[model samples]
Target: MRLNPLGDFIDDDTFALLQQHRLFDAKSVRDFQIRKTYREMRKKMTASDALDKLQELHPYLQYDTIRKIVYMSKAS
Candidate 1:
């Protein structure tokens, strides 16, 4: 069986919001270019240049958020 990616962190309100948006119980976020883009960013960019490059690669993706999610999930 599949569980939520955020699992217990997903409270009733967030679940309801997802359901209301016709999205429910998803386990993974799709279409992120983290590995590919971050690698390239690492190649030519320093910290100051990262955000601009990342935005070019993915406008909607927030690096810190994804990092936190993956980091927390994997740490457990």
Candidate 2:
């Protein structure tokens, strides 16, 4: 069985909101926002540049998380 990476972190309210929006439960809204940022950054910049820009925009997120999202989007 596949396990949701965000399962441990998602709260009841978040899950309800996701259900209402027909969004996948695997990622939270914040996670989706970060991924969206990564995707936008990947469009005009190198992965490193994208990661740097995303980190600058969201200093609270860890570097590795931004890097992973940027790289994964590249792979797709």
Candidate 3:
């Protein structure tokens, strides 16, 4: 479980295993990428601006929904 440059949590072998077992979690991977992108954006702009930019990238999600996803605990 090292994080790759692309923010993937599992190594290729583990990813392959998970895929083979049909246990790969697409939603969790998407959330992780969203959080990673948000953190990187925060370093260059205000939180509000970052959220707005993220919202632009994901028009299906509301601002508050992105806010919750950005701030949500890892255990969730």
Candidate 4:
């Protein structure tokens, strides 16, 4: 019932509703998590360090790719 397993960005009921309507975008959710993680990491380190750690966690993503994702505007 929980579409957002990474965090509670939406309530379970809302998530379930979105799932039922097939309105959930897993990629968007993932990107949101990535941004959230980067923000949290930034609190403890420099921007470059945060991006470095993010890249380490997601080795499949290039440093520039992670940088783009982390710095991307929410309106996108």
lDDT of each: 0.53, 0.68, 0.80, 0.81
> Could you tell which candidate, 1 or 3, scores higher by TM-score?
3
**Winning model by TM-score:** 4
Tens-place lDDT digits, model 1, residues 1-76: 2233344477666766786797843334432234434556667877447655655655675777545432343333
CA RMSD for every model?
A: 9.8, 9.4, 3.9, 3.0
- On residues 1-76, what C-alpha lDDT tens digit does candidate 2 reach at each position? 2133345678767767876798874444456666766778778998788788888987987899777654564443
Q: For candidate 4, which ten residues in a row score worst on lDDT?
A: 1-10
Q: Candidates' TM-scores?
A: 0.36, 0.51, 0.74, 0.74
Q: Runs in model 4 with CA error above 4 Å?
A: 1-7
- The lDDT ranking, best first, is 4, 3, 2, 1
Estimate the TM-score for candidate 4.
0.74
Candidate 1 stretches greater than 4 Å from native = 1-32, 66-74
lDDT of 3 by residue, 1-76 (tens): 4434333555777776676797857676767778988999989999999999999998998899899989998774
The local distance difference test score of model 3 is 0.80
lDDT for residue 73 in candidate 3, whole number 0-100: 83
What is the lDDT, from 0 to 100, of the residue 18 in candidate 4? Answer: 84
For model 2, the local distance difference test gives 0.68
Backbone clashes for every candidate come to 0, 0, 0, 0
